[model samples]
Target: MLKNKNLIMIFREIKVGELVDFVNTVFYKNANIVPITPQRAISQANNPYAQPNDVALVLALNNKEEIIGFIGILPGKTMLTDERFFWNTCWWIDPEKGKIAAMPLFYSMLKITKSNLIFFDLTPHTASIVAKMGFMTNSITGTKVFLRFNLNQILPKKYAFLAILKPILKFFDSCLNTMFAKKSAKKELNYQVIKCFDASMEVFLSKFKPTMLTPFDNTFFTWISNYSWLTTQPNEFETAIAKKYYFSYITQSFVVELLKITHQNEFIGIVVVTCRDSEMKIPYCFFDDNATEKVLEAIFNYAYNKKITTITTFHPKIKEQLKLKKNTVLFTKQLVKHVGYPKQFETLGITNKLFQDGEGDAVFT
Candidate 1:
């Protein structure tokens, strides 16, 4: 619907400086728009296997000559829907700037991408405001923390950017892991690998809303948590097509024994981790507080064996506890929040109860 609607539209891939500038303006913070030195960026941008995110339609408003509002979109498969979608992801329109910045920018994006659904993450800070814009809670993706043993040994860029920040993260991951390890002793002692994709869909909603995390697109989140993906899809075409398109987005993380492990998989408690493909780069991994020390030991053991230098985790609690600096680079994939506020989730030929309550969907998505 956003078309030729006013504020002149300019579509282009976000230049690092431009994006950093916009982020600074909207968040009202001072930051350096440092060049992204991560090798991952190059993979998606240059590899044929890469399904790089689309950003050829960024909309920026200029009042006279001053830049005003902007919208950033990251494209992805609609959380649960089949059709391609262009999530309305991120928008920043300073009230004073008026619709000049908002209106045209939106229309321009609609004109460009071939998206059926669009969305934005509904974090605690932006929940109420997004809800007011006709958004509704859809699902809950818990943000968990994982304490790592070595900071410099796990992150990809530890030597470069985090050399100075390593000690802080090391201390943090250590303290939390110790605390969690103690608590694990009292946990229900239910580490039976409960079900190896076993015969159970037992999803126990956490009682203590750790981060007050909630989903704006509940169906999407729920479905993702359920029918998670693997290199193989139910159908051949879908699987082949997916891999062909998403190979880059899909990092080749080690598959258990494929990588080295020091600690045996006894009943150590597991931590929380977010593995979303966009927004932030690294997947989040928070450990069970009681089993934190074991986690660190295992992590260090793995590093030692594989000669792998570093790894990164985005678990908020762990990030804070470890004092890991924000990677500073964010990829905003556009998403359409829940299409309509459903009175009771009126399904329209959309039904997936397969993994209804198992595996937490955290590992698969």
Candidate 2:
């Protein structure tokens, strides 16, 4: 532990013994906050990039040794290029200490990690701060598409236009659905959607070429499925909440759907989707160039069948295709940024790489 005036900073890997208390105090103590359980902590700590006994956290403590702030670290590896990187997630600092206190912790992370560091899904305000802190933002922007629009449900009560426009939006959405159905019908594609992550998925992903996105190889996918914190079993409290609220409650476990496309017993494409509530996000989609439209149509068909109100993607081609449709709504534009060593992406030969919405902790709502 290093002392700075009245405050002390502790840099250490997370330990199994302190995992429970650490998770509760850092993520769950507030009544409004949902706490991470010991199981989730253990899984998150099992990062492939983590050194032995590394907890991937920077804890700020007062003179009394009570935690005042913390920043989470997630280690990841690129599949095709075999490049390793660290993603910074879940940053929080005590309001009483002021934002200035966060600088030391941020600097600590940069000093410690040998691999490149990335920050995903940054708000404009946070992006501005990170830019000033020496992190460079990527030129690539994320894409989102809404398949359904609920004016009154999404808008605040103060907006009278929501109530007035709800019926109109509903009618328009109905017509849009009909148009989508027509488009899907025109494309006679044969594919089967499965909810399993297995060797077959490994085989399919092996054929995929990741340009700018994180590689989804067997090892990475296995890590995501077997060791990701989002895969843990929900505790009793979470189970009760899920039982009571069902569709309304935040999901405790990650939900993934793999669409395996085949025609005449030959593999043609694969689409992997992650879902949170009414939104479905495509993290990986690889198909023959000729099959893009058909694969997209199949994805929409699945989303409509599952009652998903929104379908989003980060692939530039998919975004362009979705934009061509009259009914698709733009949800939000996402920005990704990076810092630390290995700053030159051109040297790494991943200048054209594409990032997806489901990368890092984004898949976990």
Candidate 3:
């Protein structure tokens, strides 16, 4: 336990009861925090990353024993090196306590784990603070690119004039699409996109060579599927070839669409897109170089047909190729940082590995 004159900090694994209480008291009450059901809380408590008898949650309270802030940690292991790391997630501090309150909670997490901490999906403000805290920012950050499918819908009401320009934009966009379209046309191919996972999907994923910062394997995929609230649910009547996908519109603000891409009756890839409001973000895409363009074309067509305003991705290769197409915009660059020994990272030689959006809990959101 660490304490200041006005603040009290405790370092311990969160229990199931406390987890439920926090969800009801803090998450349910706050619009910012995503509410978790009792079952989901139990799943989090028993997650592979959690220490026995404790979910990796750190809490801060005032003299009245009221919860003021918390930091959730998800345990992870490097596939190549098997190095254990705690992924920092859902960090928050009550605005009333001021920014300084975050320091104690962060320091407490470090003290408790005494291991490497990986921070992904950091905003500019949080990135600056973590950099000052002795965390090394990865030189290879994630790239993001956006393609506006429905220009008129994306334009704000105040910029209604932009609606008139939509036709011009679409004309230019079509020209660019034609210029970048694949030259070689094969036989009229049939592509199947479904929401489900089966043994066949697992077999396809096995062939995936993880070139990202995070090592993803069967264990990681299985762990991710357990969060029904955060991820797409399996369809009850799904066949061996197709799995059903479900999302809670009321509770889950975001929807993860897992599309198993197949061509000519063969598994080509899997594309996972998270949709929120008018924007759709591609967090994970597993396909070969040959299928990259095809998969992307399928996604773009789907988005357009669905009237999705924007489609975005953090994959460098995808972003690079999309930039060549008309109306594709480079939105922003995300910085990834870690609180670990420099020598360890150097030894791993994965500092420059490619990072995707769905690499961590970023997919869940």
Top lDDT prediction, candidate number: 2
TM per candidate comes to 0.36, 0.73, 0.68
- Off-target runs (Cα >4 Å) in candidate 3 are 1-18, 21-43, 46-54, 98-100, 139-191, 194-200, 210-212, 215-253, 263-266, 327-343
**Which 10-residue window of candidate 3 scores lowest in summed lDDT?**
238-247
lDDT (Cα, 0-100) at 356 in candidate 2: 62
Write one digit per residue (lDDT tens) for candidate 1, span 227-251: 3233321354333333423122233
The global Cα lDDT (0 to 1) of model 2 is 0.59
Candidate 2 local lDDT, 103-210, one digit each (tens): 767777666555366777666666676777666665445556666653434563467667778777677766765655333232454667665656766676665565
Which candidate's TM-score is highest? Answer: 2
Clashing pairs in 2: 13-55, 14-55, 211-353, 212-353, 212-354, 213-354
**TM-score for model 3?**
0.68
What are the clash counts of all predictions, listed in order?
47, 6, 1
* Pairwise TM-score winner, candidates 1 and 2: 2
RMSD per model, one decimal: 14.4, 5.8, 8.4
lDDT, each prediction: 0.34, 0.59, 0.57
Candidate 1 lDDT at 209 equals: 21
